[model samples]
Target: MTNNGNKYLAGAVSFAVFAGVVGPAAAVSWTPPGVTMGVPLGAAFAPGIYVSNLTHYGDGPDKSITADVPAFTWSTGWKVFGASYSAVVIPEVLKVQNKVTSKDFAGIFSPLLIPVSLSWNLGQGFFVSVGEGIYFPFDSDVSFTTSGQTSGWAAETRVAFSYLKDGWIVSANTIYGVTTADDIGRRQPNYFNVDWTVARTFGKWQVGAVGYGAWDLEETVTNAAVGKGHIVGVGGMVGYDFGGSKLLLELTRAVEQGGATNYSRNDTHVWARLTFPIWKPAEPGEEHTALK
Candidate 1:
């Protein structure tokens, strides 16, 4: 890779903070699956402004969604409890289709704001990080918007850990989310999900296997507590460093659909991500992670 530092930033933010997929039924968690592939979890970052552009296409029975997401991260020199602190914000444009209804809906989805992101290095290439974020709805009503807009506002917590040393990148990130009742008198089920990655760096290329799963934690309007619905997908990722930026491509196929109830679980997802630094200080901030 042209720059090991910049190459890994793609890994650190692969989890896209708070992108969710919704279907006719409360298929699963609000957060989409496989959003964390291609990158390591909680990679230590150098103080700077970094940006990522992602285009995601998802398909399922009777429904599909295409999303354009732009995210900005700031690794500030600020410290929180001995850990380097960072913040991220994301906005999205969505195109959703209902194959059965033969109708397409397009609009902006709720934006995600992560105000508290803290990463701590435990040495030996191991790191732990935590973040708190909110998926706040826009003031205007999007009643015509597809489920891609989700039911209402959501609050989520992110916890991540990564092993980045030598030429190996292994990591896991988890999100636990709960939503408030929407204006329509419905609330998404409380949910838990995880994204995991295992990759090896070879020169300028990184290849790995990635997967994610989501399960409901409580009953919702459409589901019973005994047989709650879930979603799971497994895929592969390939990434490369281009000196000026990093590029990652990922493909994931769903392995489980919530039986005949949640059709959105049976689908395919693809992602193309590009990450680059916008500004860097003359005296670069130290990479909080120490690689021996």
Candidate 2:
């Protein structure tokens, strides 16, 4: 879950925007920025939940193990301005299954992370969303490694944006480690990312191709010590509609970053979710005719 791409802030913004305008159209799936076309607005809203399992293999001297129950409940709805908003709560664990052998031994812990975001649908195929939330380091075991010792607690700030058109979508997202928990005395600087996708829909099916990457910025060193920093990833998703609800299945590979010694090869992960309508469809306005 420490991968900047998996950060709560960026993911939440992506989901909110997709659910608001995309409707039940599938194929392009959650493929951001490159798959927008003929999408309507303000058609859905209801509280739902999402669960995902992620496995990351870093390329370096250290081995990482991130196995946990990462689930979030969301309450989302549309705005009168053709915008959308959501609130989420997620708790998960991170562990170092295999280290470099020469490092001091400590333990792993689970933390509670929450994110809230609001996106504005800027009519005629343009949209944007911005949000701020806290990652409370409630886990006693999550820590900082320095000078043969371990520490705890890290706080972060997040921001994300996306633009849409008939056949393309462009997006950029970033997170900043602005503050630290009491156990960890200092906070790092910034971590950022940019991703783009292009796609088209055919009836109930949509197809898209995508590529994205992340990098460290400012005082932040991209977590090089524990084996992190810079990434290039490419992937795609296929979607289908089951009438009342829609389903999306996705695949992605991490091309670089996540280790200190060796760069990991095409590490893969999958995502799936179900979305339902929260409200009844609005009635179409009647056509006006002059009395003959």
Candidate 3:
């Protein structure tokens, strides 16, 4: 019989072992400046920080987990051949606690995630983006289970589209992910994620509703007619644009789930992101200087 034990362990380990553990909301929460996925901001650099708090409450009272993550991100982009290309790197610190056991695990300098993407403006308020991301296990020694340590790489590809007109914004982003096998020869099932947002702008502030869902594509080892991993969430988001800087806040609650999913019922997630331009292109006839 296929051992299903590793599947549960993989879920928990993936959360605690990776830097992107902000929660399911993190998978689809970010919207690039201008809320246009296909329009490329030219020759700019942005360095920002994000802080997230996530709480997970399983069906059993002893299954509660809480985590706080502080992440630092750097992004740079340039225009290329009528398309925009950008890359981002994120590194994070993790602090997770088990409410029932009162046990805490603090991880410093977790894995790093690098994503590279290219976008094209399809004109008439339509845009498209295609990108891939990779996660490098920088802290491979940390283990969430006694069965084995977590050490592996992950990779994913994403496609996104958006429409913007008259201060109204609508977009959808999707991702597919797979990971390498762990020391115990257990591999995480391939998964698909979908995220969407709809918002209207009022001067400098934009308000919207956001939703996300994830589903595992493969069946579990036992083939016990159990549904694959699945979870869904919905929330509200607000943002303000300040010239070259922007601030965004979002809160979401898990509304649906399958037994094999990683999230808990009624799980809550809160996220805050601030981004500011570090470098900007020169204006017409402007002198190029390091200070500028």
lDDT per model, in order?
A: 0.65, 0.36, 0.47
Best by lDDT: 1
Q: Candidate 3: deviation at residue 67, Å?
A: 6.1
Model 3 lDDT-worst window of ten: 25-34
Candidate 3 C-alpha error for residue 171, in Å? 1.3
TM-score for each of the candidates: 0.83, 0.55, 0.71
Which segments of model 2 are wrong by more than 4 Å? 1-83, 93-96, 99-115, 140-157, 163-171, 181-189, 195-197, 218-228, 244-246, 256-292
Model 1 C-alpha lDDT per residue in residues 1-292, reported as the tens digit of each score: 0111110000111111112232222434545556666556576567888888888988776567787788788889778898889899977776766565565655565678989889988889888889998888553222212233333677889999899888888988899888765544445567788888888889888889988877777743332223465767889988888875888898888787562124355688888988888986888766742111
> Candidate 3's residue-wise lDDT over 237-281, tens digit each?
887887655666766666776744444546565556555445443
Span of 10 residues, lowest total lDDT, candidate 1: 1-10
The clash number for model 2 is 10
Clashing pairs in 1: 11-39, 11-40
Error of 2 at 42 (Å): 14
Candidate 1 at residue 230, lDDT?
70
The lDDT of model 3 is: 0.47
**lDDT score of residue 221 within candidate 3:** 31
